[model samples]
Structure formats: C-alpha cells, structure tokens
Target chain A: EDQVTQSPEALRLQEGESSSLNCSYTVSGLRGLFWYRQDPGKGPEFLFTLYSAGEEKEKERLKATLTKKESFLHITAPKPEDSATYLCAVQPGQGAQKLVFGQGTRLTINP
Target chain B: GAGVSQTPSNKVTEKGKYVELRCDPISGHTALYWYRQSLGQGPEFLIYFQGTGAADDSGLPNDRFFAVRPEGSVSTLKIQRTERGDSAVYLCASRMNSNTGELFFGEGSRLTVL
Candidate 1:
C-alpha cells in the first residue's frame, strides 16, 4: 500500500527560528514529490515539486529537498506570516493524476 | 491569472440532503481534480477529469458521490443522501497537464452535516 506520513504533527517556533518538517512515503514508483503551504481559511498554495532523488527547490525562506524514501521542508528565519500547515504529496506509478498526501505539519511561528 | 475558486465557501445541511459544490479552475488548465479533506488530515483524491472525460474515479467512496466537468473547465461535485461521515472540506485543483505535477487548489467548500 502507498502511504505518506508527516512527522511532528504540529510545531511551535519563535520568530526567526529555523526548523525542518519531514515527509516519509512508501510507494510503487515515485513520479514526483510536491510541497504546499496552506493558510487558515484558505486553500493550499503550491511551493515546489521535486522529480528525483537529490532534487531540491527553494522559494522565499522555504526550501524543499527530496530523496528516495522521504522529503524535507526546511524553513529559515520563519516569521509569523509563515505560519501555516505544510503539506507533502507524492505521485506514484502511472495511474491518474491522483496524489497521496501526508497528514501535514501545522506550524505556528510566534512573534 | 486568477487561481481556482470554489463556491459557497461553507455549507451546512442535514443528513440525507443533497448538496452540490462548484469549482472553477484556472483558465486553460486541462486537468481537474476533486479531493476530500477531513479534519486534521490531508486531502484524499476523489476523482480526476481530463478534459470532458473522467480519467479516474477510483478514489470516490461510493455511488453517492459524483463529479462532472462538462466543457473541460469548471467542475461540480455532487453528493446525494449525504451522511455525517461525508462532512468535510471538498477541494478542487487544476493542473496544466497530468505530467506537469503542479496542482493549483481552490479555497474549498466546507460541508457540515447536522
């Protein structure tokens, strides 16, 4: 069975603090790994897509890295505006465009 | 360009009532998808429409749920005889193509069953 699990379900950090969120997956064939940021009362916003192991992408203060079995979302000098739930999804095999997503990491950056 | 948008940001209905949720994807997006997200969980795939045809409906929970994208642009999700278990946020996303891999999502329509 294909599954994606995110760790530290929730995290609280002070402003300017840095941290990393983890997403582990088990799938047949990895097509791509994606990261998204979702704010309260709003839809998810696309962050990055990593297509292969050793691939990395960055936007603003967030960086996403991928490996064979997992992905990591690293936040640097995060601010309150960065507080949101971070989601990681994976596309497996060659089926439809269905994406299996992790539970998400609820991040709160306190100022 | 504007992002995906869902109608009736929130809906409250009694169990067994029928409800319709609308989703407007970004213009020119060829792939549309529907997903359901329960509290504290990630979105689960429900269906995917490539153009006017449903390329995949395997994730749909049962016959009570149906989705349609008539002109390959806007899509609607219909739920018949809704149960409390069906109460959740329905998300709509659109991508340029299946292989593009980047999905732009809508604010979602929140459904509450009483």
Candidate 2:
C-alpha cells in the first residue's frame, strides 16, 4: 500500500527562526512529490514538485529537498506571515492521476 | 474566474439527505480532481476527470459518492445519504495536464452533516 506520513504534527517557531518539516512516503514506484501551503479557511496553495532523489526546489524563504524515501521542507527565517499548514503529497508511477497526501504539519511563527 | 472555483462555500445538512457540490475548473484545463479533507487531516483523493471522462474514481469511499464532468469543464460531486462522517471540506483542483503533477486548488466547500 502507498502511504505518506508527515512528522512533527505541530511546530512553534519564533519569528526569524528556521526549521524543517519531514514527509516520508512509501509507494510502488515514485513518480512525483509535491509540497503545498494551506492557510486557514482556504485550500492548499502549490509550492514545489520534486521528481527524483537528490532533486531540490526553492521559492523565496522555502526550500524542498527529496530523497528515496523522504522529503524535507526547510523554512529559512520564517515570518509570521509564513505560518500555515504544510502539506506533502506523492504520485505513484502507475499512471493514475490521484495523489496520496500526508497529514500535514501545522506551523506557527510567533512574533 | 482565473482559477478553479467551487460553489456553496459552506453547506449544512442533516443525515440521510443528499447534497451536490460543484466545481468550475480554469478554462482549457483538461484534468480536474476532487478531494476530501477531514479536520486536521490532509486532503484525500476522491476522483479524477480527464476531459469529459472519469479517468479514475477509485478513491471514492463508496457508491454513495459520485462525481461527473459532462462538458469537461465543470464537475459536480453528489453525495447521497449524507452521514456525520461525510462532514468535511471538499476540495477541487485542476491542471493543464496529468504529467505536470502541479495542481491549482480552489477554496473548498465545507460540508457539515448533523
């Protein structure tokens, strides 16, 4: 069975603090890994997509790195505005368009 | 709108009642998807439509949950015999193609069954 797990269900960081969130996945064949940021009362906003191990992508203060079995979302000097639930999802290589998602990490940046 | 759109931002109904949720994907987008998000959990895949055909509906929990996209642009998710367990946020997303793997989501419709 394909599964995705995200660790540190919740995290609190002071403004300007940096942290990392983890996403571990088990799939038949790895196709793609995705990261999203979701704010309260809204749907997830797309962040990045990593297709292979050792692949990395960055946007603003966020960077995402991927491995064979895990992915990491690293936040650099996070601001209060950056507080949101970070979601990770994976697509298997079975040609299905469906994506399996992780529970997500709730992040809080206190000023 | 420029992005995907979902109707009935919030819905409250009683158990055993039927409900319909609508989604309008961006123009020219051929791949549309539906997902359900329970409280404090990630969105779970429900169904996927490629153009006017349902490419995959395996994620749907049961027969009571059905979705259709006739014109290939707008889709509707119909839930029959709504249960308290059916209460969740239904999300709709779209992409230009399936290979890209990046989906643009809409503000979901929050469904509450009591």
lDDT of 1 by residue, B49-96 (tens): 999999999999999999999999989999999999999999999999
TM-scores, each model vs. reference: 0.97, 0.98
lDDT of each: 0.92, 0.95
lDDT of 1 at A78: 96
The reply for model 1, stretches above 4 Å from the true place, is none
Candidate 2 scores a C-alpha RMSD against the true structure in Å of 0.8
What is the CAPRI rating of model 2's predicted complex?
Answer: high
Model 1 / residue A88 / CA error / Å: 0.2
Clashing pairs in model 2, backbone N/Cα/C closer than 3 A: none
List of clashing residue pairs for candidate 1:
none
Model 2 residue A64 distance off true place after TM-score fit, in angstroms: 0.5
The digit string of per-residue lDDT tens for model 2 on B2-66 reads: 99999999999999999999999989999999999999999999999999999999999999999
Stretches of model 2 off by over 4 angstroms after superposition: none
Best by lDDT: 2
TM-score of 2: 0.98
